[model samples]
Target: MKRNIKRIIFVVAAVAVWVGAFFMTQRLLEPKYMDDLIEGALTAEYYDETTKHDVIFIGDCEVYENFSPVTLWENYGITSYIRGNAQQLIWQSYYLLEDTLRYEKPEFVVFNVLSMKYGEPQSEEYNRLTLDGMELSPVKIKAVEASMTEDEELITYIFPILRYHSRWNQLKSEDFEYFFKKDKISHNGFIMRADVRPATTFPEPEPLADYTLPATCWEYLDKMAALCKENDIELILIKAPSLYPVWYDQWDEQIVEYAQKNGLAYINLLDKCDEIGIDFYSPETADTYDRGLHLNLSGAEKLSNYFGGWLCSNYQITDHRNDPDISAVYSEKSADYYAMKEDQLRELSEFGELKSY
Candidate 1:
């Protein structure tokens, strides 16, 4: 009996130690986006949201940097969140929509058509930015499988330590500080940048032998639409007004035809720049932070205001600003939003550019 009791205690202690060691190693090896590479932190922040959004925006930087959910709520009483990252792919977007449905179903799911340009996984660095923060689940597993490049391994995503363990020698103070918890990096998934860089000339897009979006891209779009349909949600597709990367007429026609065939609403904001008050040609009305690739805070507010008004007028989305509970939550969010803006402006003034953004 004494030997058996000792043996049981030994096993229990061994298991506890192993579990603790595994978690600690995981924490140490994980990327802490508190410092640089903050886009990496955006994906995981959605889980921390306490209030359910009426609208959810899912895509790459085009959606996140171009639309401000804070502006949407403040201007139209529409609560929204953007699940976006750098160079997010179409398959990743579809799986993200699938994962989002596991939370609360929103009235509208807005996806940027820019991701449709790529048919296959682009890079491992981009894949990590979008997928590393997602929780361990079948949805995440599928996203990993769909987003991983040829050189990437599934085990690295499952056990991130395998991917980042080498960074032990280069771990910064942020790695230790944010190991257990991280500061909120976005206002409703909008990474606010206050600086302005006017659009300049770019090399003309090289003509593609094929203007047709990849069949695989269309497959994911169908999946996203079907998933939204299953939940009785309307999916709205839009092309954000990024001046570079030159959105072609051929691509626009394909998206327009798809939307018409499926009875979905598709808006090409690039065509509505004048109506939306976004001026890429004028330095006085500059809206982008990195030339014309992404919108800054000023442009995002303008786009969100226009889009919100359109949404309220067209869709069944309601003005929740009067709801005391929801209003209270947004009131706090508004405070944080302005605070971040002020900080960014201050940083720009001091350095002639935004350092943190």
Candidate 2:
């Protein structure tokens, strides 16, 4: 009986060694798997690295909807990238920031204030999504090095188990691909051109209730603030525009108070949607696509143009769209797009229906 037990142990050890060898060897052999899983996974063509002082936008779909790196590159001359995710939480934001600061550090981080307005999830989503979609880069180690408690930050950042205690399933070979590819650019933003839906306004996703944020969400938000301060990176907290009914119902004076207390730079475009110029009540709209949550090509163009102006006016960025090569691409792509977007802007300029939150 003892001999049998010893035999079982030896067999288990040997199998573990063999499995490790296969993964390690395969990783070295087919590093493309790493590239495939992680590469160009988000924005068009994925993971395109930019130069110094380039803007880095981080958040959920809002970031995607609000800014176009390609447009930023073409319009502002300051290259940028979107590190947005779908349904990402505040905890995930911290990790994403912690992980993102690894590679090329940006001049500033535009953190979407929406998560601060988020209702905390009861499940492990906050931590799980952070760990799962988490990509560790050159910034991860530096983040730890700069962390107040280096040891703990290093442990949690390295393993994620310390931070996301519920992350039990170890990363298999498959995850390695995702980790590496998260850096890629996503091409499919606001790609759809035509819109076909009458726009009224959306009801509150819930009732007309004030949002009471969870403490953990606040903890992550504070960590992000501190992390930015520690790294000497500027944090621009934006309160982006959405429809009025939902916007008023979701965010209130309490949210306003929190932003003020944090010394966050708030850009509340809620009522300024008209000043920014968007035909929200237009007969044709993006509501047909993704119901109404995301923006279409027409919207994205307006956003890029608006944000492009904002970046130029406020941020220390230059407009280089005149550069022959970029403009050639933009000019080529902007043909019909320019027409559609201009019409939207013109219509919005004419139709004044923006209600303040």
Candidate 3:
């Protein structure tokens, strides 16, 4: 009996050490989005949210960079979160919504329609930025299967170390600093930029040979709509007021027709830019940092304020600002939001750009 016990203990100890070393290696090799490429960190940050969100926005950078949840909370008492990624494909957005539902179902789901233009996976780098941060689940598996490019491998996502193990020599300070955990880099999913660079000129949009959004894109959208309906959640589609990658008339017509067919509300904010008080062309009042591609902190707040009013008027979203528990959560979030904004401004004033983000 003693001999048998000793053998079993030795095997267990060996397995434990091997398992620990494998995970440690995985952690050390994986790219830490802490210093730069921070957008990769956004998806994982949602899991750390303490209070439940009433509205969830999912799409590409347009949804994340153009809208501010903290502004919505302060102005209209609406609590929200954005589950956005860089160049998020429609299927990925749908899967992300599904993944979000696994955690908490919100009263409303807002999707940006810019991704409708993409029918297939764009790039493996973007796929990793969006998927690697997601917690392992059936939804993530499906997202990976749908998002992987021709050259990409599925096992690489499951075991990122397989893809990044060679990064041993390139590993930086952050690789170890954030080895155990990551810092919250966004303000309720909003990446703040206080610097301003006004829109000057944009390259003429070369007309696409085909105006019709792909069948695959529409199919995933149908799935998104059906899932929202089954969960009794309202879905709102919007074309954010981005000046480039022009929103063609033919494309807008198709979305309008679809919205009518499904009894959904699709607001083209590009049409309401003037009404929303956005001065994209003026340097003194410009809201975008990279010309008109994405909004700065000032622009996002303006957009959120207008959109929040429209939402409250059209829907019965409960304002949790007065709710003691939720209020406490927002209070802490608001403090962080302003502090970051101040820091970004200080950085911009002194250094001509932000360094901490």
User: Which has the greatest lDDT?
Assistant: 3
**Each model's C-alpha lDDT?**
0.91, 0.54, 0.92
Which parts of model 2 are misplaced by more than 4 Å?
A: 1-40, 43-53, 122-133, 136-185, 188-201, 208-210, 249-252, 285-288, 318-357
Candidate 3 Cα deviation (angstroms), residue 135: 0.4
* Candidate 2 structure quality by residue, lDDT tens digits, 1-357: 999999999999999999786545433332222233232134222233333335677776666665555565555665565666554556555766776676667777877766665544433422332243335565435433332222244555555434544433544564555433433224322232234343556664675354666576677778888898888777777655545225543454555676689776656655556766655555555422233455555565566677767767876665655667655654544464455456655554565321110
Per residue, candidate 1 scores C-alpha lDDT tens digits across 65-113 of: 9999988998889999999889999999999888888889999999999
Residue-wise C-alpha lDDT for candidate 3, range 235-313, written one tens digit per residue: 9999998887788989999999999999899999999898888889886779998899998889999999989999999
Candidate 1 weakest ten by summed lDDT = 278-287
Q: Over all chains combined, what TM-score does candidate 3 have?
A: 0.99
- My TM-score estimates for the predictions, one after another, are 0.98, 0.61, 0.99
- RMSD of candidate 3 to the true fold? 0.9
- Stretches off by above 4 angstroms in model 3 are none
TM-score of 2: 0.61
* Local error of candidate 2 at residue 153 (angstroms): 19
